[model samples]
Target chain A: MKIGIFFCLKVWNMNAKIAIQGIKGSFHHQVAQEYYYQNVEVDECLSFEELIDSLMSGKSDQAVMAIENSIAGPIIPNYALIDKNNLHIIGEHYLDIHQNFMALKGQKIEDILEVHSHPMALLQCMEFLKKYPNIKLVEDKDTAETARRIHQNQLKGIAAIASKTASEMYDLVILAPEIQTINNNMTRFVIINKADNFVSKNEINRASIKFELDHKRGSLAAVLNVMSDCKLNLTKIQSLPKIETPWKYSFFVDVTFEKYEDYAKAKALLTIMAEYFKVLGEYKNTKP
Target chain B: MKIGIFFCLKVWNMNAKIAIQGIKGSFHHQVAQEYYYQNVEVDECLSFEELIDSLMSGKSDQAVMAIENSIAGPIIPNYALIDKNNLHIIGEHYLDIHQNFMALKGQKIEDILEVHSHPMALLQCMEFLKKYPNIKLVEDKDTAETARRIHQNQLKGIAAIASKTASEMYDLVILAPEIQTINNNMTRFVIINKADNFVSKNEINRASIKFELDHKRGSLAAVLNVMSDCKLNLTKIQSLPKIETPWKYSFFVDVTFEKYEDYAKAKALLTIMAEYFKVLGEYKNTKP
Candidate 1:
């Protein structure tokens, strides 16, 4: 009880600033805004791995990593760092990934001969890219930088796959508004911090854990059955291979328990789970 | 019997062609070679997400996602995709991420006033960047692409951060070889597919799992204890917040164990891991 109280006090003293990857106006920047609010400062990094490193090294108090998106799916490279760094997920942020094909003012859509953006941005605009065959597709470092590139170069024949913020920042006109091929394009961001930070009240519906199962056949089935038999609703499931194994994976699962009772039951079922696997952590989620 | 024969006959038919995100000679390209070998055909996508989509659509038999580098640490964005994708990890690849500082054929390192590359490439060459503080740092997309960009634009007094392959590909001169700030930098890649195609090898020694907890105190300790009791060594651990909850995490773990007895013990411990969490999956590593 003392430790818990001390931990909360420690949290209260923290600046709680959330670090985000990308320059200002990047999607991660917005997600950090959603969490850090007026009092928090959003720290920027050139790469996602550095963002986590900054947090792990005491440079920042927290971080938000783009996990998965509606059209593109998850960010796979981030998983390696999240694994390498011991940062814990404290919250989740779902941001609307609104993309725009922006170009310099007075540059007509027909004037565009190339589209540049972060790979995902270009891909989200793939269907649009197909429509304009002459517009060669290229990738920039980030969505915001894409706009910055066109503006700095004063390139008339180039457009950028970027966000509304990026367009506004670079004074670029939107040739194609919401050019993302999918209307449902959304990126889920996971806010991470040192393992000792507060889990937060917002985490009631969230849980996180890790485990390993035997290599034999039916081992995976037995592991999944633990969730199904307990009647827990699984929202997401993904597995990554260990560096030492062949054709085996360690799985990550997100489960939605309609009631607290189900959550309790699911936790209880982990006892049987540990019999066949290795449990990592079961922690609550916080929304930002 | 039929299933066993079907499995037996399927052994020789498994020809996995993996897609990776990069141009011809990025670190990811090298890693793909580690897994699929010279016989394998590599399909290059511009983005990591596209590689995942390629696997999703069966456009590529498998996809290789760079997870982390030893000296550079984790590639955190890839972790998000791993959590978001339905693809299973069937293998692992490690590539040395060596960086070369390059420029136009006639240019000397002393003559260079600007450096360009993907931001991460720049970061990997941070020490190099620092040494030439007067030089402007320009961010391009990929290391190889950056080299290509330098060649295409014919920028004066400029250098690029890329691999030896980029120098060879673009016919540029390596102004400074092995200029990465981190000399020991090595990247780990995961070859993912829709199917769990493992031809059992007795030497596989590691596994991975993801899980969520019941939002209780001591949950992490409870799970860690399981690994400790079973003597499983954890090489990596990452926690991402569960979106459904405002402040909870789903933890991913990479644990090391040897042989049948150890694998069984690890699984047994994971079964009980649920007193507070959910069990995700146990995986075998395929890194050669």
Candidate 2:
């Protein structure tokens, strides 16, 4: 924002562009709305690849990606995409995912013989789906788009799992309001920029890294032992297939190098540690 | 085999019954196909909840649940169901998910104005979907059923992200084979039996646990510190909404709990830690 402001004042040649995936009414669009002002210029991409490509080619200033949903552990491919694309993780945000059971207006819950939702929504509402065993569980691309279908199909025996906003958008009734099984559902999204938006003075010992080792016996265990030796707590570890090296694997680890060690000490430990491993990227934990 | 032969010689008795979600052509049904043979009398449940209920009531000898997908991460709600129902994890299996892009016969890719799929499948092909930005994405309950509609409606402009088996089942043409964004995609399925399958043999280093903590500042941090002190390697931690307990939070943790340590050692740690925690359950980790 500082550089953008500078260019705006000095030469009036810059705009803070935000890149997101999907059309309007998609969750990515909703997150962009939350952060970026309405009417803010957003370079919408049809997919994550395009968004990453635009971010790489300087077509967009920054890109927002969904990291995980309450119903899904992590968007695994997105993680690999960010890693493969070498996009820096600058900031993180959370969104409350409220899923509604929707249908065409005047259609009661009993009238619905099938329920459609994003696979994750249906997965999250696994328990609710059981109540209507006769009704089928279908996966849709976007939650809001599911609502659009029930309206378009004009079928009284079908309903959708979507946000409350979608219900009004398509004039659909809330068939089984708040059908998502877990009430405290949330999704974590990351804002990425090519320029450095990390390096926080409030850095609380959090680090993100990617590593690919010679696939051999005890390779992962030996690497994990080093972290335990330093008493660094490992928060998460997810494996993405070796895109560059066929039949191999890469692992992403998020850890908090002890606060007592200070930033310099933490950096030193990670630096020496990188000799035997690959250090992907490090960002301050932005979670409040 | 010896026991079965003896039982056959003595008298006929009931066989083991297993329950799973989805009808034919669905991924769950395919994943369940791995175990649905011989002694396993597989029963189709319309929803995941029924699968769980069957396991809980001893109506089914076991239940199969998909925990995670390779392209996607872990299935979030299935974890919640596994935690809520008092079922023990006995084994784990992986299913390679192949999503094929299908359309009615004689339809071409250029003619596709709409794409239908389960939400997960659509999300996976998001990169491909971007090219057809004008094409509407329809969320349907069953990928196979969507294919069935394309053939029935003769909607030349419509395509469905389904499985190869589904296209064969519906006699549809493959507009784009292996339409998923990622290759080598797979899903993790867990077989949950009601009985405690804890054994006296084999490496028991893995343990699955769920806990509720007082919704307070640093509650999660404090729990992490405890696990760290025990030298327990935390692999995955997911937060599930404590719907029954307002404002309280529950977490599911998979960890390497030192296999050499007896059950008492692990249980004692959780017990001593219970004043500030709720120990949901302790079972073997099927992943390792």
Candidate 3:
């Protein structure tokens, strides 16, 4: 019956392959479904490298990657991956992450002796988990995988902290819903595609750019000053330390503008001022 | 013999109680030992929160917290922890991190079936571990604790990726020294104290500050202009999402200058320009 529903939807959204990191019912899967058509073909990758590989190799048309979490900050290595892969970020997404604690059917909260989930997920729900002193928290590779394992193994005293979709997929019961300490936690994801075919509809208010600077004193400050002069609003700035160079850093800045010409002017000045610069993406600002 | 040396050194550096985030031979322990006078009392805390608690509760005079790593990037939550706890960053230290692969004295590389370490250490040594496909990587709470457990349990066919200090403390032999993918990986640790009593010795050059801007567009850019005007070199900038507020962000910046008065001038202007501002620390630049 579920397959019938899936088939009907797949027929409606044919040939839309979206790659993400994790299995079905995972946060990435949820993001892909929500961002794109609901029944788009899902290309699941075990790791971020594979996710990018799927996109680069033409196996997947697009990819949804979690760029940062409100609680954990940016996934720095991912920025490096996207930069090195030269993938174009076409859009951005903000996911309201609600971590749920689940266990086998007929099991009460007291019956859970051990809890398992991804390390980051475990960290988010640490405050609530502390109340259950007897339950040991273990870090697994994936939250959905943990839920599936408990369901398959019929583990009587074990629970998994995952999403509600995972609980439904694995036929488990949610012992405690919304376990994350911050009730309003959110994660930002970036949508990437192989081609930079994003045509600005005069609504492109935000852009991401990466640039390298010399070891001079006011190099970055000068760039920021030019951005202000051009009427560009610097929303975010991240400094990634260059791998080979010991102390040098490459700056990634996300800026927004009222007019496209202003952003273009800032880009023109930055091209001359920065040693090396690349605009990762320019998209409609989703967050005001 | 080691106890005798420790007692003599303790006498030389009396009344120094340092708190760190792991067991005796963990990275935090090594950092504390390297940053402070050797043989000063070491108060081991299980987590970063506990480490801060030790300093706040008068159990330790100072704390050494890892702020960033070359390979893994910044430990962002620690920055939030320090900022929220109202702790003072007294100084900074850079430690060359060398992750070593070790096991029982008689074991060879091929004999090990499983490797265990902290997740971050495992990630650093991922390239090297790929060579041994048969070995399963396990993430433990602490690298030093994992080594100690292997020795205590008489566990064979199991190796641990930790520091040389851990091997010595656990009576293990180094099977492969410096197994980290990046040979020159370094971790930047901030020396924090409860009391903001660090007096500049005519060499103060770096200052870490936190500020919040009104949702106005060019507020951050304006702050950068002030820093430039004051001859302050912006070294690092990190934006942390304000938890209560949805889309707003607070910036944490580290800037260096030749003259202290220039930094004071920048601070004086920033205080009036920003909605919320705090000087996290002002210390002598140790990153030459």
Best by lDDT: 3
TM-score of each: 0.59, 0.70, 0.90
Off by over 4 Å in 3: A1-13, A56-59, A198-203, B1-16, B132-134, B200-203
Q: Of the candidates shown, which would achieve the greatest DockQ relative to the real structure?
A: 3
Candidate 1 CAPRI grade? incorrect
For model 2, residues A1-288, the per-residue Cα lDDT tens digits are: 433432342344336677887555567767777755554567777557778988998987877888766455666778777766767776566787777888887888777787766666777776688777778776555677667777877868888888777788788888677777777677777778776544453443566667655544334455566566566666556555454222245567666664636434544555564433443445555443
lDDT of every model, 2 decimals: 0.66, 0.65, 0.83
Q: For model 3 chain A, give the 10-residue run with minimal summed lDDT.
A: A1-10
Error of 1 at B71 (Å): 3.2
Clash-forming residue pairs, model 2: A138-B141, A139-B118, A139-B119, A140-B119
| Total residue pair clashes for candidate 3 | 0
lDDT of 2 at B260: 41
- The DockQ assigned to candidate 3 is 0.52
Ranking by DockQ: 3, 2, 1
Candidate 1's TM-score reads 0.59
Interface RMSD of 3: 1.8
Second chain TM-score, each model: 0.85, 0.78, 0.92
Give RMSD (Å) of candidate 1 vs. truth. 9.7
Q: Is model 3 an incorrect, acceptable, medium or high docking prediction?
A: medium
Ten-residue stretch with the least lDDT total in model 1 chain A: A278-287
lDDT of candidate 3 at residue B19, scale 0 to 100: 90
lDDT of 3 by residue, B109-194 (tens): 98999998887898788789878878988777788988999899989999999999999999999999999988778888998977
